[model samples]
Target chain A: MGFAIDKIRADFPILLRQVHNKPLIYFDNAATSQKPQQVIDALVHYYTYQNANIHRGVHALSQEATDAYERARDLVKTFFNARLREEIIFTAGTTHSINLVAHGFRSWLQPKDEIIVGQAEHHSNIVPWQMACALTGAVLKVLPIDENGQLQLETLKSLLGPQTKLVVVNHVSNALGTINPIETIIEMAHGHGVQVLVDGAQASSHISVDVQALDVDYYITSAHKMCGPTGVGMLYGKKELLEALPPYQGGGEMIKEVYFEGTTYAGLPHKFEAGTPNIAGGIGFGAAIEYLNTIGLEEIAAYEHELLMHATQGLKQIEGLKIYGDITHKTAVVSFNIGQLHPYDVGTLLDRMGIAVRTGQHCTQPVMDFYGIPGTVRASFAFYNTKEEIDIMIKGVQRAVNMLQ
Target chain B: MIIEAQQEIIEEFALFDDWMDKYEHLIGLGKTLPLIDPQFKTDQYIIKGCQSKVWLRAEQQDGRVYFWADSDAIITKGIVSVLIRAFSGLSAQDIVNAPTDFIKEIGLNDHLSPTRANGLVSMIKQMKLYATAFAAQNNA
Candidate 1:
């Protein structure tokens, strides 16, 4: 079925907001998506009516909150199609999730053991692995990308060997919007008996993720990027693998028994979920997943692909404007620069026109260094975004270029 | 006279109701900013904590400090130009003592983004550091 974009746009209250006396044309979905009224209402519902801590609470409100919280975990597990609900661990976000995994792997990884990360990784994915390598004495390797901003799979094949302990790569490049060949990468890594962690921070919103089909050892994504609240995310791991890894943090929920002499940790997901979780955030994240399912990921992907095509065509018409990344297999993210004008200047001008676009290296400084540019103006789209909005943005960029030049 | 200069800037910003017009004015100011020497664009003169690369140089002549600055981003360059216009060709002590309330009076600080605000703060800090350095040299 064709996606009903206008009706979907109405679901978000922030779309009605005006910036600088003009209608807000938000194109920064890669950074964070606008929450639907349903998701916001879920948060309010949790706080107002079902406000209580989970797990240990004996009260009805506590049980209700616990039920909702655990149900949210089920939603995430189902969303990613994991084998067991116990495999899904709620986290502070993608960064926290990756760091948690890295922390767990620190003791397991040996000196001279290799961990491969892509050149186009967000700092979240790169820095944690770097720290993990530093702690374990493991050597860090790079998976190089070609001129088109796609990962060089041939090089990745060569990089994978007996020494390679893990492979970490983003499912979609947040900076470039390139959809990586994760399925293939996973297959290759598995063949080498290596673990693979797919950073799905940018992919969850635009595509459907099946952890079972891909069989990735670890999959990390943030709720905020997928129309959910901030400070909440999930990490999907194989149940055996998660059970094998030690507890990431020492806390109340993560403990099976507490003893001053020695401590035994909780099993599976609980062992990793340390401390008081973002209870409200998890409930809201569940609501967000429900919201996305209503529209369907396949439908959203198709609609966004249409938007990408239209935007690419419209933006290419502007002279001296250069679009980065391989457009063939990418999300609806257009990262570009016009002539000699700085991205910040163009972004500033766009803001005046009531358009919100990201203008910076986007936490992928290594990618910027590869391109030999400081940054590009990134305008990423979602299912709710319209063709008319793209048209307005193209015109706005043209006007900005004219004014700046 | 310095306060009067700030007032003039406030009045100048007041002429534009629309942010677009104000930005256009800023761009015009940026275009007219006196170019810094290529040698001065080195890492030593560059201001840290800015999203944009900003190079600032201070030259003391006749016991007065003249500030020259440049930025890769036009809006940032424009912002730097405004600061230079307010502080340049003044005595080191005078530059140090000059009120930065004009940034608020003109609503530039409020209107600027968080990153740009940080940049603005860093720019002001760099200028003040230069003023203090020059003041110490003269006193010594």
Candidate 2:
């Protein structure tokens, strides 16, 4: 891989711009990755040339539209190494994908069914399952994380038993950037006859996912997190499992036949995709995946890992700063707070220098509760980010701390 | 400002939607937020829970309550803007009795995310507590 940082930076138009009279140093990749020119072009191409309703049209435009949509699905199928294209269902995003499974996976969910989740899982993953368990009268069990913010795998294993029907785990902790041992998680759960659903929202862009290799029953991810358009994502389930689960929503295109007597639903993926979806979004998503593949995920991940390590070391030199989520073997997210200065204050000063970072709980309130703090100033990275950007971020935080002190 | 003008401003609080839209002008109505006085950054007034540097000042005028908040962060300033809109010119009783649902109705929380919503709630609570004290003094 070239690791051509300049070329990669050039591909993103927004990175070239300035904020606050300073060149933009976007460190908010964990919030959403910037789109490459190719992805944006693909979006333009879809809306410009091949715009039409998908799946059921007999016209030429319809066939073209259907091909583009199916092609995106096939790309995702290969991207994740899903067993079949039919097992992949398009969703609005990771939140919707997880909610679908949480609500529709009621088939095997009995009263008192035990569900296991990690304390570090994003609220999107935790809240839905919590609500589901509350509604179903099932038990919501948590797999606690150690001080370093890594999941306690042994504890997770001990928590799972015969009563455990579904296990929800994040492929990567969005807040702490901990790469979970999902393969072990899946194997252990399956041995106890439990299904695992992995939240791949934060992991999909940074790591290569093979649903077959991991043997997870369900996997969900957001396209926006990976440089694709928002409001588009995919849910991958084992063919049998997807077939067994009921449709999450009912509307046009998810039916083979509908009568007052009864309704016969469409098979597999379409059964879940009711109504007109983000056709342009699906095309743009494929484009984003293609863009990521060309750069190579391993190369990006390796470079970002190096960046995080370097930034952590550099940031340590600054005084009165407490870095949150300082776990080894983490991804590119660095969260911290300066002594006596709020993370919001820290963030505001950083923003004035055209350094964009996410501040606050990052939607993982449990992690905040665990740390006994309300929030942190989170600087997340991506392939396009550089060492220089991290330097600027560090300087900004230091200045804020100094002025406040 | 003139007493009649202040009275008109106080009357506008009863019509919340109008107050919300015109909050920025009202904040400009004060002594321009004092350049945020960098000396106030000590540990004493530091809000432990917030991600931004939110400094709050509550004032009383003719039995009514007002708040002036400034944040170093932009979105947090926008949040403070909304808080001032919701709470300024109202009495302590009205401030306490006012529902959080008004925030949802304006779709203020839409531009903000869930985590930001939590911070905004905290900010609003702090403001209401100050209002409660003012209301208590007036009642006494």
Candidate 3:
């Protein structure tokens, strides 16, 4: 179906609102996309009608809730093209998902073993592996990126040594919007007899992911970034790998049988998910995937690319403006800074004009350290954003530069 | 205690019809702020905020305390300049006793409020810290 931008914009209620007496121009989709009416209604309906504990109770309410939650898991598995239903594990979000895998590897890794991560990863990805390495006495390695923000794949070749157990990298760089070649990264890492865990938090919203096609050992994404509710996301791990790893948490549902001396753990997903999960958020996440299906990812990607080009061309016109990342292969995010002006100043001015953008290091301090700058003003676009909005932002940047100068 | 200096800021901001002029005036104020000595610009005097870096220095001249500061972000520098204008050249005790209500009254509550993590609030806290240190020295 063709993209109906006008009608699609109406689906988001917040798009109609105003900020600072000006119409809201939301350009912070990378942080979190504005929820659609369908997603909001899904949450409300779940709480109003299907509110009950799952997997334990036998009443009609309990059965209905259990079916809804399981149906959500099925939807997630199909969305990411995971092979088995039990392979999809629900967690708080991407960070929680990563920590689960990191914690699981504590016993699997030995001293002097290695975990290699991309230089462009957000702190969430880097810190977890660091903690895991600290615990297991394994060394953490960095696969450095080029000046243009592309990962140096040759360095990856060298980094994957006999000691390397796993390679961790993001499908997309959140700070600079560099779409790392994960398919190639996965293939290269596997050739060296190592497992690869891909952080798909940034890619799941922009592109359709197929874990089977990529042959990725593990993949994870947060729901909030893709027009779904916060506090819930899906982690897709191979069934055998998940069964091999010990449980990240222990509670009521995750246990097979309990005894004073010994307790047996449950299988696959429940093994990782302990206690009650975000039921409503899980169902809402299903609704969000359905919503994206209606729009079609191909259409969204094409339109967003057009907007990114429009923004890049307009921003490049300004003197002394430097944009980070490889824009040609990246998602629709423009992170730039004007000469002699701090990103905070520009971002604050844009907010006053009713534009929402993210400033600061954006939780990627290593990338900032690489660029030798404080931070860049990041403006990310979604399918709901329009060309008119990009023009307004371009004008906003020019005005901010004039004022700061 | 330093309401006179703060009132002047409020009156000056009231002349502007829009936030643009107010910000332009703020930039002018930042330019007018007395620069801190180059030696004090290191991390020793640095108050690192999430968004920007601030270098603040305080010294007791006779019976009164004086403050000098700078920030990489010009808008933040302007906010700090106004704060310094209100608190500097007062006795250590008076500086300690001075209320920061003038900041909100000057129409900078949203961006540079004391509660914000923009380093301006930390700057205010650092100012009071210097006052307390000097007050302790006087007692000693």
Best by TM-score: 3
Question: lDDT tens string, model 1, A257-334?
Answer: 988999899987899998999999999999999999999999999999999999999999999889989466899999
Clashing pairs in 2: A343-B51, A344-B51, A344-B52, A345-B52, A345-B53
Q: Which ten residues in a row have the lowest lDDT in candidate 1 chain B?
A: B109-118
Candidate 3 docking classification: high
Q: Which one is best on DockQ?
A: 3
Give a tens-digit lDDT track for model 3, residues A1-405: 567998999899999999989999999999999999999999999899989999889899999998998998988999899999999999999999999999998989999999999999999999999999999899999999999899999999988889999999999999989999999999999998999999999999798888999999999999999999999998899998999987898898899999999999998789888999899999999999999988988889999999999999999999999999845998999999988789988998899899999998999999999999999999999999999999999999999999999
* Candidate 2 per-residue lDDT over residues A1-405, each given as its tens digit: 457999998999999899867899999889999999999999999889999998888999989988998999999999999879999999999999999998886655778988998899999998888788878888899999888888888997789898998889899888878888899989988888889999999999998988898889999999999999999999999999889898889999899999999999999889999999999999999999899888888998899988999899988898767777687777898888766566765675677678998877899989989988768888889999999889888887776665444
Looking at model 1, the pairs that clash are none
* lDDT-based ranking: 1, 3, 2
Off by over 4 Å in 2: B2-140
Candidate 2 lDDT for residue A187: 91
Worst 10 residues of 3 chain B by lDDT: B111-120
TM-score of 2: 0.81
lDDT of 1 by residue, B1-140 (tens): 67777788889989998777888888899987877998889999999987789999999999889888789988888889998888888899888888898887676865444456228888888899999999989989
Model 1: CA > 4 A from native: B111-114
